[model samples]
Target: MEKFTTLTGVAAPLPIVNVDTDMIIPKQFLKTIKRTGLGTSLFYEQRYHEDGSENPDFVLNQPAYRDAKILVAGDNFGCGSSREHAPWALKDFGITCVISTSFADIFYNNCFKNGILPIIVSAEELEKLLDDASRGANATLTVDLERQEIKGPDGGTIRFDIDPFRKHCLINGLDDIGLTMQKAEAIAGFEGRMGEARPWV
Candidate 1:
């Protein structure tokens, strides 16, 4: 996982509520365990038509939002199955941060694990961010993890709260595997001692 200290980029407005995992990457794209390549398929159904042509109406397919690094979505985002692939798809698509009024518990946890920042804000705050995101190519927003603040295009700021431990993990680029590696020396020492004691067996 990459370290996430601060990020400033265009934000895409996705005002639809109750976005689920299937709606994100779709079941057809779930066979691969690898995280890469899913970005093109992110929101596959909404981003493509029946003939596999690009859908011009989807927010992600629009000219201004094609490269958006942040997403400002409606309430109840990520509200279905506990698929970790959802966050993987989002991160693969260059969206490292997601701001919404509410999110499903499992999806929210998955975001942090995958180096994606999932922010929860008041309904009023979401409206403001959405308004900023509606500005086409000028929808830039800066997310500073250290300060727990979100700076909008017009120089407005919104403060958010996150668990200290999660913040530490993201700042250091420590995933579950990375966390285990931190104890490698101790683990090796214990293994050596066990090997000596079991030599007779």
Candidate 2:
């Protein structure tokens, strides 16, 4: 996982609610365990038509949002199955931050593990962010994790809260594997002691 101290980029508005895992990456794209290549398939159904052509109507496919790094979505985002691929797809698509009024617990947790910031704000706050995102190519927002603040295009700021531990993990680029590696010396010492005491076994 990459460290996420601060990010500044365009925010695309996705005002739909109840966006589930399947709607994000679709079941057909789930066979691969690798994280790469999913970006093209993110929101596959909504981004493509029956003939596999790009859907011009989807927010992601629009000219201004094709490279959006943040997403401002409606309430109840990521509300279905606990598929970890949803966050994978989002991160792969260059969206490292997601701002919504609320999110599903599983999806929210998955975002942090994958180096994505999932922000929860009041409904009123979301409306403000959404309004900023509606500005096409000018929907830039800056997310500063250290300050727990989001700076909008018009110089407005919104403060958010996050667990201190999760903030540390993201700041240091520490995933579960990375966290375990931090204890490598201790783990090695314990294994060496166990081996000496149980040589017969």
Candidate 3:
């Protein structure tokens, strides 16, 4: 996991709602547990045709959004299965932040665990962000986690809220394992004490 403090990059507009995990990476791409290579397979079905050619009509296939780091999507984003690979694919694809009106609970948590910031804003605010993203190559938005604000292209700012613990973890690049490791010394001490107390076992 990487620390997510502030990110300023092109925002890709994905107005379609109910984007599920399968649509993100597809089941065929889930054979490998490794995260790095999944980026190319992100949104595989919609991004490619049956003959393996790129779909020019897809938003991600467009040249301007090919390297987008932020996604401004419609409501109910990440609404299906609770696969961790979904966030892995998004992060691998260089999407550091996702802004939407609403997101599925499991997918939202998975995003944070994988170092991706999933932001929820009002419908009105999302429309504005989508408008900014419509500018194609010029759709650049700045996401400042510490300030909990998103700065749009024209300098307008939208505020968002996040849980304090999740915010701290992202700032410090701490995942679940990282959180547990924070008490390494105590864990070691406990093991040592247990061994001394129960030598026969």
Clashing pairs in 1: none
Instruction: Give TM per candidate.
Output: 0.98, 0.98, 0.98
lDDT of 1 by residue, 103-167 (tens): 99999999999999999999999999999999999999999999999999999999999999999
Ten contiguous residues minimizing lDDT sum, candidate 1: 192-201
**Each prediction's Cα lDDT score?**
0.95, 0.95, 0.94
Residue 181's lDDT within candidate 1 is: 98
**Stretches > 4 Å off in candidate 3:** none
Residues 22-127 of candidate 2 have per-residue lDDT tens digits of: 9998999889999998999999999999999999999999999999999999898999999999999999999999999999999999999999999999999999
The list of candidate 2 runs beyond 4 A from truth reads none
Could you tell me which residue pairs clash in candidate 2?
Answer: none
Model 3, 71: alpha-carbon shift in Å?
0.7
lDDT of 3 by residue, 1-201 (tens): 789999999999999989888998888888888888899999999999999999999999999999999999989999888889999999999998999999999999999999999999999999999999999999999999999999998999999999999999999999999999999999999999989999787
Q: Which 10 consecutive residues of model 3 have the lowest summed lDDT?
A: 28-37
